[model samples]
Target: MECPYWLTSSQVGVYGRAAPEDFTADYEHWKRVVAQSYLNGIGISWSSVRNVMDMRAVYGGFAAALRDLNVWVMNVVSIDSPDTLPIIYERGLFGIYHNWCESFNTYPRSYDLLHADHIFSKTKKKCNLVAVIAEADRILRPEGKLIVRDDVETLGQVENMLRSMHWEIRMTYSKEKEGLLCAQKTMWRPKEMEIIKSAIA
Candidate 1:
């Protein structure tokens, strides 16, 4: 299969091209941080994490790192194109699932931990931010954690939306144009509240 133009092209956009070695190194640093987050129960502990989803796993680096720690991981990409299949396979990323961020194919409460790296900034330009958050809320189990990294411009909006949903912000760090946040899903709302929300929708 031909590589997708987005992956192969030199045109700059939300996701710019990077040297493979540099990308790998960056991912490695994040992997350690995420692993520590889990181990330290930053939002939720490793013991609480049974299944994880890398919402925008490029080259499956984060997923691979979680797997090395004996965690069950499913790597998801926005596009289902064959462009990344060879790379996925080469990296031994066996648990791959494809779906757009705004809508996923997984069942409700499917994952204990969901990680997104620079995904919101890219998707927000193309999809509804509310839809993306709702989908993430649906798939995450109650008390499940979400770890996200994105540029400063998009991070504020994303943080506000998650806060509005009553998700507990567990940790946050920012440096220049980049930011990282971890949040945990709380209890379900009252049925009447859901009904009112549905009505509003």
Candidate 2:
């Protein structure tokens, strides 16, 4: 079923921020832009993907964007961001409040896909990014995909970290310092080994 382009937002004309219409248009544009990555670059197989998590969900737009797909999204709003969770609930969507610097409450391998929009740059000043990525690894299923959008420098840093983690870099593109990266988690782990020393005469 298709979701209506407009949603009921109590923050409208009251939050005194941007216009509600502007937010609607913005997220709609974001939805279209994200769809392109799926169509051409990352090539995510939605058939097997059932669980999705929007790590820095703003007004639950990413979840709205994928409404047609047979998947449910856990829209996670940052504690530092504005209070938009109420608006998300008003729109018939559910989500949780979280601080990415800390851990998200869930089991290991809980999600099939995790998407973050500029979250790394935002969190780097506040906490350790390695912890955030490690938490992501703990929750994402094996071979699950992760998509991130950030500045080019942050993208490069995260790409290198992911490579070290043995995650395959699926796609990366940077446009004027704005970048996007997609990677798939692997099952590789460090193996224990023993070495024997030989004495030479």
Candidate 3:
């Protein structure tokens, strides 16, 4: 699907908002943290990972890090901006996908690891956070890991939602208004069944 808005330039943007300065440093820091979390927190090795998806990939920094580890990576951006696409391409991120976070075009059980950085804060304004979480659950393989980084305001709510969905919280780090959480999908609940359960109760 095409992006809802056009981004004219690549000026340190994330979650449809422009950063005050270059986001390279932030991206690099998160990349290392995420990798370390997967290794130490989640207890998963790089060789065990086959495919990964970055749900709100801005300039593909995280994807690049995974690629360096020889893992197949897919980066999805919500916007269809002309300016950002070229920069993503320039970074040699050819596997980039475009779609809304709450709705994706990928097949079910398509990824081993899914990453979302500051996506909840952004999508909470436009779509149902539960829908986005459900979609993430739907696309991830059983036992797949979901790594999320978001502002502190929504951390508790996000954690509760994931727990309600049967995800196992692996690690969580929160300081002031920023946090990172990693959880693993341990079970599957079909969408139809979820609706039925909701309707019946």
Candidate 4:
């Protein structure tokens, strides 16, 4: 059995005159792809339930993947509301899913992989995939992985930053011109700290 892949999506759906049959078929195809990659687990976080409702025509694949892969699922939104964080925590998922967008601070030193699905894009000028990589490094265990897929203009910059940080570039690919990069976190030596202390003495 191969290791499963993790997936995250942003605003993926059909709307406005697309036939229901076509919509449903496309959604199923997306889900099957997600299911096949269910190794470490699976997660889906939407900006709103309404935003995801029309998208659900594609979610049968998600549900089927969850069933076949025994993967975990989560839903989140930007605004804090009743039963939001509590529900996510109750499910034992990576909790407070909305926090990923909270003004982009560095992550605390405690997580493993930081997975981003469709968060970055050429049209939308908001998300920073490199900051996300830094945050993942700050929080991940040594040799951990960061999985990201997005519409990026500078794949080389992402790869270069990871290498400068001593992270290993594991994989990269293109899907319809969108670049996906997979990098592994590596241990950072405290050589500078040691040298500074020795000089002071």
lDDT of 3 by residue, 2-70 (tens): 122343345436544454233454457657875776556755656777889887776666766665577
lDDT (10s digit) by residue, model 1, range 1-201: 222334433433223454354345545765787567545645456776888888877666676666646577777766643344445566666545554543566754388898988778877776676677777887898899998889987878888988888899998888988988889889954355442242124
TM-score (C-alpha, index-matched) for candidate 1: 0.76
**Pairs of residues clashing in candidate 4:** 4-38, 4-39, 5-37, 27-58
- The lDDT of each candidate is 0.69, 0.78, 0.69, 0.44
- Against the true structure, what is each candidate's TM-score? 0.76, 0.84, 0.76, 0.50
**The best candidate in terms of TM-score:** 2
Q: Considering every candidate listed, which one attains the maximal lDDT?
A: 2
Clashing pairs counted in every model: 0, 0, 2, 4
lDDT of 4 by residue, 73-159 (tens): 333332322223432333333333343323333243343444544443321244454554454455556765665666655566667
- Model 2 accuracy (lDDT, Cα): 0.78
Listed per candidate, the RMSD to the true structure in angstroms reads 5.3, 8.0, 6.0, 11.4
Q: Can you rank all candidates by TM-score, best first?
A: 2, 3, 1, 4
Question: Comparing 1 and 2 by lDDT, which wins?
Answer: 2
| Predicted candidate 2 versus true structure: per-residue lDDT over 115-173, tens digit per residue | 98888999888877777777788789899999999999989989988897899998888
Error of 1 at 89 (Å): 2.4
Evaluate model 4: give its TM-score: 0.50
For model 3, the run of ten residues with the poorest summed lDDT:
1-10
Query: What's model 1's overall lDDT?
Result: 0.69
Off by over 4 Å in 4: 1-30, 35-109, 122-124, 127-130, 152-154, 189-201
